[model samples]
Target: MTSAKSSENKQAFINGWKQSKLVRVFLYFILMLVFFLSSYQHLIVSDKNMGENTSEKEINQETPIYSEYSINSLDFLEHIFDKLEQINLDATFTYEEKTEIYKLYFLEEYNKFVEDNIKTMQQSEDSLDAAFIQEIENQLIDQQYDFPVEAFFKLPRLSQAEIIKMSAVAESIVKNLMKEQIKEADIMRGKVAEMVNASNLSDDDSRVLVTEIARFSIFPNYFYDAAATKEALSSTKTTETNYLQVVGLILLVILFVVFLYMYIKQSNLQIRNNNVQLLMLVFIFIINMMGMKIVALGHSLDYPYLGFLAPVALGSMLIAILLDYKLAFISSILFSIFASIIFNFENQMFLFDYRYGIVASVICFTSIFAVHKASQRSSILKAGILITIAACTSITAIFLITNENVISNYIFSLTFALMNGLLTAVFVIGILPFFEAAFGILSPVKLVELSNPNHPLLRKLLTETPGTYHHSVMVANLSEAAAESIGANGLLCRVGSFYHDVGKTKRPNYFIENQVNSENPHDTIDPDLSKSIIISHARDGVEMLKEYKMPKAICDIAEQHHGTTLLKYFYFKAKKQQELTGELEEEVKESDFRYPGPKAQFKEAAIVGLCDCVEAAVRSLSNPKMDQINTMVDKIIKDRLEDQQLNECDLTLKEIDTIAKSLKETLLGIFHSRIEYPELPSRDKKGVTKDEATVSI
Candidate 1:
């Protein structure tokens, strides 16, 4: 007893929590937060490159100073060689003048090289080649030149052997000097060629010289600057400012809050009072957005719209099925907006990419439209197909209009779009039952399933109480039409009517509908006892429904169909018998003969009750005429109205009149008079004329 009480209290608290206004507000806020966080990474934290400083001076200043060493070594050597070669040895200038000029040029080149290298070393942190610099300084300081050009020119008038020997000695000295400063063999060879070509000697002697001067001079390309490259790469990475993004996020949040507020305001009270549907809506939205986010992260795909495969229409279909189309449409719009944000691969925060958004919106809207009247599970597949077609068509049209590569985009977009539909169908089939069970939603698909003749209770009614099953079927048909006319749930009326008389199956012989054995069980029983048996069916049906775990709405219809009306047939019989027994003064309470009921609390249940009576009354008529059908439907509706059976429901007088007309037309069609048939010709024993024996037409 303690455990039971604790469990009851826990359930009550849960119910209270679910219905609390503060809890609703908190849940709405949490949904808003989920919306914000789902797109935050894509919208705010992406690369912007706003803080980079691209000034030329900054780039040049940060350039590595060691690059100057490569320039100094190559340029200084070329300058010395160019000056030496430009000397006018064949002109009026003497050898001393050329030698002095050569010495001055060499000294200038050497001083410049040393100065540039020292400057480079000072500016560079730790990358300068110190050993190479020292070697250059020692070689330049130790080198001695003795003006061998004049000696060679004076001895050049001698034999070829002497010229060759002189040229060889001169070449030897220049090669030795060139090897001192230039470490690379290629640069050393070029320098030696320049030195040998500038010698004051004959053409043959110069040609026989070891070094040959090429027509063109080689200069070094710019050296790679490790520090400068590193600095440039680091500079490209900018520190993003969050002020604008924060503002944008705030604006978006405000917009979403306003939108959600309007949505809640326009929704039904049931939806407003229950947080399950609201949370389910938000959950579907978040799941789709998260799926899109995951897809967007793979930007490496060739087709930009390949991420359209995310089941954007899944939420729309679910909302349309589990709730209504208006909410589905609104949710689709919001989802499209978020999709645009997530698919904005360029990170244009406030700007939306309508290319994907439009496609998603169109697909979702089409799915909702297609599934708006869906009453079966297969309808979802139809909606999926419609969604896929919309997706592919919209995507293809956009690509065509925008002059994108149609062939490639179509290949990927079509595949993903088709998969989008198939996957949506799969997901809806898998998750719809969960939502229905969780939210206690009696969807049209569920109603259709329950209305099938093969249900356990329904089959039992067919086999055990076949007469009641037929009566229930007629009631279902009548109730479906009447409920539709009055804007009630016709499917609910039909399904509820099917199970309303299932209790009669337990005592088939006791009820008039199932007494096909030509025996009335009530004939031998007392009137009071007969009334009790008749009134017990309604309560029995309620208990049976509860035992079978049927939906509460159906159980209520089973219990309330007869309401608290007086069982006049049995009441009058008992009163007549009492009069014969000299107990006429004893009062018979009307309540004892009535079926126990809490009245019909909803329009569908009330309509089902009225249809049940109309069907039974019309079925009992030997030949139901149009006038009789009309009178019967009207009288049943009038009687129920007078009994206050419909007072608790929201059915208006105009709707009641409409239901009467629908029931009358449906019954008249069912029991319309047939044409009289002529008797078939029958031969007499003597095989006389058959026309004489046949009846007249």
Candidate 2:
């Protein structure tokens, strides 16, 4: 009991782990971090090229750094600009004012003129004082004159304040002249006008001037301001990466704790069969890998995130085939999350990217109904096309969620859905032979084709033992319908029925069914010997199928079809001859008349057994009707049930009834009659010669 409890607890832990959301989130977090680390080089390149002297302190101190840099630099330029602008408005009404302002231009010609004229005036009038003459010249410089204020009157002496003012005015004039000219209208300016700007020029000229000014201004401060702003906008001061790492570690701990809690909570849940569960997990993993590969391809295509949805639609039937519906639905959601990551969620042109989720869910859910008990290449292909339609519908519905151009999106999505279905069908078809060969997945279409009489063994039976071939075909039809009606493996049952009688191919002429134009082979052997030969076929078929490496399921059907039933025909024949010959004294034992032991232990095997009996019994009817066939079917089923041949199988009584009804319906349909021909005259009542009688027979 303790051992049982431990096993149960271990199983419960596995079950809980399989469904743990915390575990999934932890894994996703790790994947995200890995992706970020792998792509960090792009961030490095974007952050390069800062100025030399710009310290981190200066960067942090900058107020609204980006805005302050733009406006403050403009402020410094603005102060210099204000003085330059006033030069155009400056006015000088007197000679003093003219002297003051004219000195600002460094008027060397006017200064020499004033000094030479003053010396000449002193020589012309000796009585005039040299000091007085200079004073008079200075006085004349302070006077304003109209018209040709020539060298004498207009000339002025240079001074320190005037020199400073002259330099300031020259700088202001240069700054104003730098205003860019329009390149198109003012053709001399060229292409620079569109990119530069200043107040005095037209729009185009202003653009050129600003661009040229900026081109020449490569001072450190010019770049420092921009670099500071970019760094300020982009750089992280709080070290978010380290914080995320810590949170990730905490999440991992919580994930483990939740897993432990659930494992403890469900400590008694029973586990499914280990082999089937493992197969399911392996299949899911392969599918996951395929989906990942497809998502990677779509990422390369630069398709919308919806492109990742293709896998869910494509792999839906595979999920339904290997796993149950609920798991398939959950897998779709998981796949969608993976797709969103693959898409990068960066450039979604459409409003509702939910199409990926919708497409995945609809295809998966719809396929659950379409793929029930499906195990054939053609059926899987059909399921794939059905899933494609579901994808298209889901895409259309999602399109309505946003006002994207309908026909274009519809066409695009439809094409993708078709490609998904077709590719899935192709992949599934390619994998089928491998799975069937390796793991022995018996598909329905394969079973139907194998059941045909043209198969080598079946053909041998037809050529050398035609009666058994006919019997096997009837049995295949019967079992196929029975298997289908019960939701069992019908195709496997049908194929098993076809090859079940292969042993008769070995010594076909020894069986009574093969005695077409001769006396019965039974006549040449004792009843005991005939019974042994008949039963040997069962064992022989098992051996032959083993040699061919047929699946255990098919081999079981072949070996169990007879199910130790008595050889009534030979036993009764032996008893009648003994009584007729007055030799009743000889002993007749039941052991000599029985097949080797072991009954049918599965639905497919049991159905084959019933079919084997019903076919042989019904074939003897000269003019069988529905009632006769029903009676034969009823007898076969009743005998099998009474013998408890179906007890080990999972078939219920209601399913058996359904099978019986379906077989009756199918037989009636297959054997339905044509209209009768009218008769004109009759032959003699005693009838014809031996040749005619032979022909009729």
Candidate 3:
């Protein structure tokens, strides 16, 4: 039997998983893929140099080729060579010709280098500038110098023989003067060459430049060309932007497919009755979407971690109220990963910051526990307050690492903290009713409504059959105490007990306790017929509850309140009747005289069963005292305990003891007395009875 039961369970699990539509499962897979891929894309694009080198290569391939050199460097060299040639011209001439020679050569060299290098030069080309330097050298050598007496004696000029002599005269004053100028010019050339070498370099090697630009931009002393630096600076940004849009599209598709899967899966549930759960899933998806959008917006605005608040608040509340704690905790983890993507993406202040996740997790835990015990809408607000506090602490810890700009970060963190609380409260308020009404979930409010004495059926029971109404109230009280003491849901137990005897309303006069002024209907009837009437109530109540479209929880209570216990009283009474009537003995069975039930499988239902018996048995005692009530309560509990009626329930013996204590207290208070003050009658001054007597206190 155990093996068979295990096999049945395995099949049930397999069937549940198999029956889930293929399209929905496929969509889930797609969503997971997209989520991972988009997250990876975000990481790649954040590097700023993602495809820069490749882009540069593509550009280089399309552009025309040329010999690479800083023509300006070559031109400067040519000027120095021309100066050497002019100095040689005056060295062999008279002092009067020296100035004239120097002026002419200087003018010629300046114009030539300007035309060849500065005027026509482009910044980058195919090859190194080796040939350009050679051309400049050849140009300098091509310049002819005339020897003159005046140029030779000139202070700035030298004779051609002197220039040739100075070429070998490395220690000469003129050579030294020329060498210093050349050295200074060479230094400038080297600096410019360095900049040019870095110009079309790989983006991965551009970090030092970026850092320099960013650091120097903070002060006015740095001279960076706004136009020249613009293209390089914006290239990384453009690539990042393109990647983000692509990733966003992918993520959007993922979210849609996930939403569709959730919607369709909910739709396929035979128990869903309508698209209510589907609508709820859609709403949760929308909430998640809203959260993602907010995060994206926050990142765009350069404010990171701000978007983490909405999902944490909303997701926690959803898991707590709409689902179980375990599922809620799992979703919290998933949302935490999503939050990292949303809040701490490319523009994030911190990498892998645990603050958002920690805050969200705390909120999730608090929400689950808080709302689990929540009996009203106001209780969610309390839970929201707790979430807000946790969120604040989490965000503040995040801000501690980001304290470089304390004021702005502090304000940003606080904004999300406040939002977490507000959104949680709002989501709980909005989703509660839809779930309660559509799913027919037995919330505390529903229990309270059904427990009202003014309910139509309860009122009918009160008027037409006061004894049954009184009996139901007692049962409700006992069941509530029992359920509470056993860590079961007391309100549910109490409300179920109230409606358990509703079938007794149908034939009030036939039931012994309800037949106050009526003749005993069972007296003339055979014992078998009487047993049928007494035992039919359980079946009738179930049918009545079903007709009203009551929730399964309530219907279960109706069906299971009277398990499959034998009707010993009625069955024995029937046996005696059969013997007295001299009827032919028909086969009588114990099962035939029992309630057709799957039995109470939970503590609440079991408690209702005990309450049903205890109420009927206790109410029959006339003017019972505290000791008598205690004994009766104990006896009823003990009888059920001994009979193992509570076997199916998960209640412990300790819990049962607590239930007995709570019941005893409640019953004593209920049966407490009200004392009346007596007044003495006074006659007016005469022994004879007066027309009117005065009452004295």
Candidate 4:
């Protein structure tokens, strides 16, 4: 039996996929591809700088590059040669110049030795000029230059013969210093001190000559060759993909999809059945992933934690408003995982950044819970402020835990978190109307707007059918109280009640509630004709609501409020007349006298319908006492339950009893003052209260 059941369910799933959801599943597949490609950079497992010269096995863009003197020393020599030639420099004039010239010409060792033995890469001209000037002043052992002697002859521009001698001495000192593999900038003067002490010249001449060489000679060069590394990095391509990570990503995505499917199946089956709502969820999810990916790309810039500005809570907030918050919670967890992967670069393999993920999750949590049932635009802003507090709190906690204690970094992260919160709320508020219009779903804000007394439909109902309008208002009061007592949507019930009898506007006198005079439209009509007119109101109200572009929930309540129950007033009147004409009960089919209906499909509809009957029944009394109102409320609820009108809805028998009690209490309050009026002794006539629930019909 279990096997058969499983097979049946599997087949049902296959049939469903082939019937309607194939396109949606295909779109999710495409989304998976987008996610994989957008996150490709971090998914790569292989080393980016896979060369022997790279000092670190794993290299990101932030790692500084170095060029060793041996591998690129010849290129450095040629670079200096080109730079000096551009300035029309004489190669034999300066120490750096003579060193190159002696290696190229005198020693005939240009091919054997590194060019000028230059130790550093060429920076921009401005940078090199600044470095040269700064080094000349700071590199010497003696702080003082001979300013008085420079009055006769400046230190750098000596006579030609003195220039020749000093150039030769400086060149020899540089060659000896290069042979010692001078690598530290801070100790260049100390090394020069050793070279000067060992010099064959007088101490003053050697000291003066070493100063010139030290300025140009001190730089770390015998290091990881940057030019070779650049060449390798540019040439390197990750041809071998990380199939493990790819498989894991695919599995994770499929798992998320399954989790979402199961969650919705159990908790929000309405979203599963509604194609537009399902499409809305997909749109929000894809937009969130793309938004996070785009924001994470900003982390490559100068900002240390740019991804904190991503509106990571956007999807959950939108879903919470437009759909159920329970669904929003599921979406939030999946969004956080994607955020963790997309914003991560601090870990090896750039796998995850728990800081960003935790902060984003916090904001998502706060936003969904805060604004799930919000009824005003300003409420979204309030939720945003709450999200900001939560996001900043998460950031501070994460930073403290990670020991990233820099105050400025903390300030920047907090600033971006604030923006993230604001943007999340603003985006949700801005796009909400468009989603409601496009998806045909009603949010709390839209519901409140529709509930306004001055709305066009409500005004029309008041002007054209004032009696029915007042009747609807009474029903709304009862419905809201009853709905809240049963943990149903009270606002939806109230709003639905306001428009439930709007069809009376089309033929105002046809309904008793709208007839102010003694004229009766039903009196002239036959019982069958009266039944048709009475049943037409539910369908007509639905049409009017549709014409006004009212939300489906309100339209549905108008349509299903009568549920297929018997129009007993007309049916019984026809039965009585038929029996006088010698017809049997079976000859007058009961089904022919019923309202065409799909029944109440949810608790709100059932509550509204129940309260509609109870209110009309109680109002039928000329002077209903509290005890009479209580009996009327309980009898109507009992009648609906016995007729199986509430079977399709999720309301329990216990909740029905609760709704009956609430309706009785609300009716008591509304009619309590009426008890003080003079009682009509004829108010409790036998036939008058027999079928009071059928007063509207």
Candidate 5:
């Protein structure tokens, strides 16, 4: 007795904590954190991929740092550029001497460069920027500063007007090309080539300008950096992979997951109250995300677009099976978005990026729609086949967007898409049992199997307490009908009804349903003793179901179906006997005769509890008319409502009315012939009465 009270108190505490607002808030925060962490890896990975753009030789090369001593010291050359116009071409200097004199001006600028670099090198070979600055200084000291004599000889041949015109154009071109930054050789080569091609000058004149600009005239400011050039070009294309965009995308996904949390709370109350099941949902999301990441390894393989082989629909299919389909529907959107990020062509992380998002969404929705109501494991394979068709259409649609219009080119991608569906089916079939068993979930298929009469518990109930078993079957029929009418799980209701009375088998003769032709056990015992026997059945049934490792939902229905209603039969009998024995009516405490209940916490349990009461009540009537059936059903439901038995469940009053009406319809059909003809007629020629003839062998 002490252990039972302790266990009951522990259970009460757990139930109270589960319903606390703090637990709900913490769970929502966990869901958001899980989703955010799933996206956080993309940031690390994308940054890691940044270094992959350049090879070891390029990455290891010293970076440019000219600020140490100003080796990029072209500032001193601004005034020196005027030295070209100082020559006297007509008399004091002959054409050859004039050419040599102008060449001396360039040589002066060149020599000044070599000497300045040598001075800069003396200041710091020891600074942090020493290595790269020394490399630049050494290059300046080593290169020859001689004039391009052969090309510049053509320059002196021209008159002063021609000399100034060519030199100014050459100087302007060099300065314009050298401004800001020039990463590689091709940009400089292309600009020079374009100028040469477009110039109307004589070939000799243009050749003179090219040599002057390339060798003698321009300062030593030209620099080339391979890493910078690659980064600059990549930045133009992959700006979406930048830090800000990725952070924005992660925040958006977090918002969507919050919506998913809200939807689960509103649509599936049972799942919301159980934190283990909620944690299981988080695990499912993680598993599918990991699957997507693993499949993405094929993205780099030689096979064309092998990312199409990712099982995009697997998450939705598993969710549809283990939890609510409405959650699967919402989670499908999130799953597809995550898959798109994994299989993305350009590493784009936008929430609705179309490259892979469209294909993934189609596969996810197809799998969910096809497998949500599935009653057998094989239905997953069927959903896979349907997903394959969707993949083909979606892949083809993607092809049209990419302008890969040749029908033959789609064969490889389409084949992989076909493989995607098969992969989804394989993964779902493989891990589904693990989830169902680990979480103790009652799926439709499991419910169907449990409803079989050959199960050990059901068979025991049938053989040991046949009357109670018959009553249970009647309740199953009525409850399943009522549940279906209210958009509930009819299969779960039927299976729960089968085992709800299994505890009566423990004391078969004590309960009236199983008394058969024997004397009433209650006649020989105190009313309190009979009441304890009656109340213990509901409790014993829960323990029995748990011993068998039944689903938690089935066990809950067994425990809560009776709620805390008064056992008026024994309560009033005790009170009447007390009055006759000269005792006060107050001697019998009403609470002692009531069932210990936590009330119905979910719709299916509430529905089963109502049907269990109504079925037993209607069965007591010798001939229950349709009006009589409706009246009894309404009264039972009304009593439960007034007693606050249905307060915990989400069922509304309108659904209750519909359920009451459905129960009446089912009971009337069950007892239709029994009501129409109460008595058996004479035996037929075959020696069987009318009722005996209708009974199955």
Candidate 6:
């Protein structure tokens, strides 16, 4: 007994938790927190460069020193030799004169180099030894006349052996000069310093000359400082300071809260009232965040815009189709913001990437508009194509405006943008069913699918109770028209009308519509028994719909179409029979003949109920004229209003009037009068009535 009580208590607790709105709200809050944490992980933590860490591998493996020196040295040598060649071949001066002029020019350049280096070194904070400076000054003086001017001047007129010997001597003089300068000026550091000090460069004057030339090249001063480089690399690893990260996180939380508050305000609690919508919104948001994470993983790739291909429109399309345009629009904006953050992982300076954000937002916004009214699967593909064009166009325009990359890079970005659209379509198609089933959302596409005549319940209704099927078709027309007139869910009303009378197939002959051949099953049965059969159809339809796993709204329409209204025909028959039997002592109760109903709880269900009565009453007329149709529609609406059938729904009086007018117009169009034809000759060669004659004109 104790185990049984405990089991019962556990079941009760589970039921209570399931129905608790506070628990659901808390669950949504937890989901939002998960999204926040995931976003932070992908955008900041995963980048491996957004936090402080002193220990790091040095980035001086390819420190650009050798390449910088080699290129500059080659350029300097080429410039000096070209000048010398120009002076040597001059016809206006002798060898001695050219030699003197070249020496003067070389001395002038040397003086300028000394002056520049002295000034730069004095201004810089690098600790220079006073002895080194004095040595540098002494070397500059010694190297002023160190060049072998006479040998170099005679090089054009000397023999090959003499020229080679003279070249060697000149090279020795330049090498001594360069080595003196390099040693005094601290030109090499780190590994280069050790290598130069230990190496025997007596025969390799070329290396010394290049190093000296590179020292005087017009490149920015760079020195190898192992400690400083390590520090800079460690700093680079952190994108933002701890204070800034905390501030950004707070701002993100505030922005998300504001967006949710605005969403609730704009929707007027519709989302909060419907747990399914709230859950779906959270589901789409999480999916979008996951897409962002997937895209952020491609940051290591060369293309910076690769994150733009995250299929931002996937969530927007699902929201627009499964929810409504308003929520989809808001969701697109939020998704674009998240896209910007995800794309900004590499660029640590900016918190958001407006370029990718604007493009993504535009594509998502355009896609929502493109698929807002999508009722078929093909429309989803068409929306994808349209959004692809929009995305490509937007990307091209941004690239053209920014001129940030070459044409090929722009082309690559455009290709990614196009792929974004195609991926969105694929994902929407694949995941839409899961969302619809999980949330129990009867999307327009699903409604259109359910409205197909080949559906099992619809087919059975057509085969067994053809009259009810025809009546349902007429009622669907009326409901669709009325729903459109009031700006309600016309497709939902139409689809619900088709399945409303599905239970009539079980006992077709008992209903008046399927009782063909002028037979009435109610005539042979007691009025109480007939009323039971009549009211049982509504409950039976609800049960059958539940078995088929139809949407709750459709099931509600089937159950509440009669809406607890008294079955007056059966009730009046019961009273008349009771009077004939003279059993006046027994009281007649209206509740006994009424349907078991919770009343229509939404606009679509209420409109379907109104249209159902209007269609049946209009069909019963011998010939429904314009006046009769209008009168019948108004009467049925008035009776429903008086019976308080529409009290539970959100329909206003003006909308109700609009529904009546629309139904009357639709019925008039369906039952319009035919034009009269003149008399025609029959096959018997005798004058026959126009109705009976079959003329082959």
Best by lDDT: 5
Pairs that collide in candidate 6 are none
Per-model TM values vs. the true structure: 0.64, 0.52, 0.53, 0.64, 0.63, 0.67
lDDT (tens digit, per residue) of candidate 2 on 175-281 = 43233211111121122232222123333422332333222221111112343455555667424543554465455435533543344235421112233333443
lDDT of 3 at 517: 75
The CA lDDT of each predicted structure is: 0.70, 0.56, 0.58, 0.70, 0.72, 0.70
- List, residue by residue over 62-156, the lDDT tens digit for candidate 4: 44333223233223333433433432244346654544443344123332332232222233232323333333223222332222221112233
Best-performing candidate as measured by TM-score = 6
> How high a TM-score does candidate 6 get?
0.67
Candidate 5: worst-modelled 10 consecutive residues by lDDT: 52-61
Q: What range of 10 consecutive residues in model 2 has the weakest lDDT sum?
A: 180-189
Model 1, position 57, has a per-residue lDDT of 14
Q: Can you tell me which runs of candidate 4 are displaced by over 4 Å?
A: 1-40, 47-241, 251-279, 299-303, 346-350, 385-415, 484-487, 516-521, 575-592, 622-634, 641-644, 647-658, 661-697
Q: Model 6: runs farther than 4 Å from truth?
A: 1-241, 267-269, 301-303, 404-412, 583-586, 673-697
Cα lDDT of model 3 by residue, 1-697, tens digit: 9998999799777545534555335435644554554344334322222121111111111222111122233234434545656554544755555556555654565456545642243232422134443443443333322223332233343335543433332222222222221212222222222332333333322322222221111111111122223343456565666567567657765664555445444542322222333344445545664565555665535453566556465755664565444445555665665555555542332334465556666766777777774667788888888878877776677667654232444666778777778777887788776677666567675577677788787787788878878788788887887777765778888889878888888788888778777789888887677778878888887888888776678878877888776677777877676778887568566677877765786778888887787667666778767898889989978977776677876677887888888777877777765665796555556653443533321
Per-residue error for 152 in candidate 1, Å, reads 50
Per-residue lDDT over 1-697 for candidate 1, one digit per residue giving the tens place of the 0 to 100 score: 9998999799789777867888788777877787788666555332322112111111223333212233333344345344444453245557666556554554465566666755665566654445434543443344322223433343223344544444454545443443232223243333444445445554664444223222112222223334444444455332233446657886787688678768777764356777766677777776666677777767654343667788878888888887778888888888888888777753343457888789889998998888887888999988888888888899888878986432544677889899988888888878888877776677888888898888899989998988999999999999999988866788889999999998887778898887776889788999999998888899889899999888888998999888787889998888888878888576777778887787887788888888888898898999988988888877888888888888977788999999989998898889999988997667779875567646442
Q: Model 1, residue 349: what's the lDDT?
A: 35
In model 1, where do residues sit more than 4 Å from their true spots? 1-34, 45-306, 406-410, 546-549, 582-587, 674-697
Q: 238, model 6: CA deviation in Å?
A: 9.5
